[model samples]
Target chain A: MKIEEKDVFKSYFKNLTLRERAVFEGGITLGALFHQFVGTPVSLKNREILERSIEESMKNQPCVEDISVEIVGNLKEDEYVSLEGKMLDVKLKVKVENTVAYLRLRYIKELNYPLMYVERIDEE
Target chain B: MKIEEKDVFKSYFKNLTLRERAVFEGGITLGALFHQFVGTPVSLKNREILERSIEESMKNQPCVEDISVEIVGNLKEDEYVSLEGKMLDVKLKVKVENTVAYLRLRYIKELNYPLMYVERIDEE
Candidate 1:
């Protein structure tokens, strides 16, 4: 974002603390990542590009410092399946000023849910 | 969900009140909707089906009672554009037990953001 455009964007989030903002943006990104790609057609042929695409697109969101997305599953080369939440493992970092929130999205076997949660927060 | 499956899911959310659960599910749906389809190829020919497909897919999320998705923009017959956040207008209903949350995902020109928020909460 241009400096002026960023200022305008930051104005809307003035009410939140830096840590809060970081966590909020992380939550939004994690939620967006799961929902948007959960039903996509995926196969061994397209897996790598799909992961890179997801990482690149999510970088456009506010405060995304970095991200890594992996699609984990076994696929037969000839067939494709709709992407499922259980197959995603993501690590996201969101920065708001000095506060950086590390967040994760992965399926937890016990809960049987693709959980999104803040892993840690750091000031840098 | 089958009764047993639903019980397992509910057990994970036992720490949350019905209102919180409803809102959390609503937020996830909204964020997911924006991120998942923003860059999809869309034109007049595929717009209606795309909208229906999005609605159907999101309904699979937990607690989603109903959802309406409208893709608003001008599109030519022969060309397609990557769907943008500005084109989405969504109303989502999430129900947790007797509580219901109405959420919206829409572009607010003043904020220059595709904003997501809880519109209202109802108890039944």
Candidate 2:
């Protein structure tokens, strides 16, 4: 699982949009490395902060928008781990103000996939 | 092009989401077959009417919603047909009231892809 997570992160770090890549690099250099040593995975709160900082840094990119990312289905919880025992078919419904987009992914361990990264490029 | 179109449509007609399939079957049996002889591909207006009628019939399904499906790119027009010779890369942004979903497809000839067919299912 750790190897999979590391590989996924590495790929994302390579292919992230210019603005996103810059933010990721800056954050890692500044504090993320320290957090890793201290045993803290980038929390939702920290992620929001980083996203906002990145958004501000890249004027061409869209602002860090607040989106609701939820997992809906029958779930089985065991202490710190909540496993979705049922067919892990998850429907991600993302709404950016008046505009809404949906996606269906199955058996996803990590909730944060690069495709779902909502930092806008050009609105045409 | 005709073969490709026919094949794509055939798949869609076969996999028409239960309610949609019923509506399509009923329409073809009643009038679509008749229209085929008269040579009329389902027009936007007629599609709207059929969509509405189907919506009413399938109360479980979302009502026929009007959406703006626009092709945004520098396009070159050739008489009755406008060809987007600019790499044939099209971004589809579909908005349903407060929700908007987007997809990016390259080298697409047919404007009416079945995946873009927005007859609503359950809202979770």
Candidate 3:
């Protein structure tokens, strides 16, 4: 975002603390990642590109410092299935001024949900 | 979710009030909807099905009572663009116990952001 555009964007979030903003944005990104791609067709042929595409597209969100996405599980060559939440393991980094938040999205077997949670936070 | 599965899911959210839980789920759904479908391939041929598919997939998320998705803007016969956030208009309803949260995800021209916000909350 340009300086002016960034200012306009920041204006909507004035009520939130930097940490709150960071987590809020992170939550949105993780949720978006899971929901957006959950049903996409994936096979060995498109798996790498799909992972890369997910990372690149999410980078467009505000304050994203970096992201890594992995689509886990085994696939046989001749078939493709709709991607499932359990198949995704993702790490996301979001920065808000001096605070950086590390967030993750992965399925928890105990809960049977694709969970999004804050892994850690750092102030620097 | 089966009775046992639902119990495990509810255990994780014991810390949040019903209202907060409703909104939190709403936020994730809105964020997920935007990010998941933003880059999907679309054209006149597949627009309606794509919108329906998006709605059905999101319904699998916890607490999603109902959802409506519209892919706005024009598409020509032979070309398609990566789905942009600005092209989406969505209304999501999430229920937590007796509270229902109505949320919206749409582009705000003035802010130039696809803003996701709580439109209203009803307790019944």
- TM-score for all models, in order of appearance: 0.64, 0.16, 0.66
lDDT of 2 by residue, A27-46 (tens): 11212111112222234334
Span of ten consecutive residues with least summed lDDT in model 1 chain B:
B1-10
What C-alpha lDDT, on a 0 to 100 scale, does residue A32 get in candidate 2?
Answer: 16
Docking class of 1: acceptable
Every prediction's TM-score for the first chain? 0.94, 0.21, 0.94
How much is the lDDT of residue A53 in candidate 3?
A: 99
lDDT, candidate 1, at B77:
75
In model 3, which regions exceed 4 Å deviation?
Answer: A2-5, B1-26, B35-84, B87-104, B117-124
lDDT string for model 1 (B1-124, tens) is: 5322465556655544566567656766788888788899999999999999999998987778999999998898799999999999999998877898787788888777777756677889
CA lDDT for candidate 3: 0.81
Q: After TM-score superposition, what is the CA distance of residue B107 in candidate 3 from its true location, in Å?
A: 2.0
Quote the positional error of residue A96 for candidate 2 in Å.
14
Top DockQ prediction, candidate number: 3
Who wins the TM-score comparison?
3
The digit string of per-residue lDDT tens for model 3 on B14-97 reads: 555666567657767889888777888999999999999999998987788999999999999999888999999999998988
lDDT of 3 at B49: 99
Tell how far residue A84 is off in model 1, in angstroms.
6.4
Q: Tell me the tens digit of each residue's lDDT in model 2 across B1-124.
A: 3221333334423322333322222211211111111222234334345434433432221222222222223323332222222222223232223443232223323322111111232222
Sorted on DockQ, highest at the top, how do the candidates line up? 3, 1, 2
lDDT of 1 by residue, A13-115 (tens): 5554566556656767888888778889999999999999999998987778899999998999799999999999999998877888788888888777777
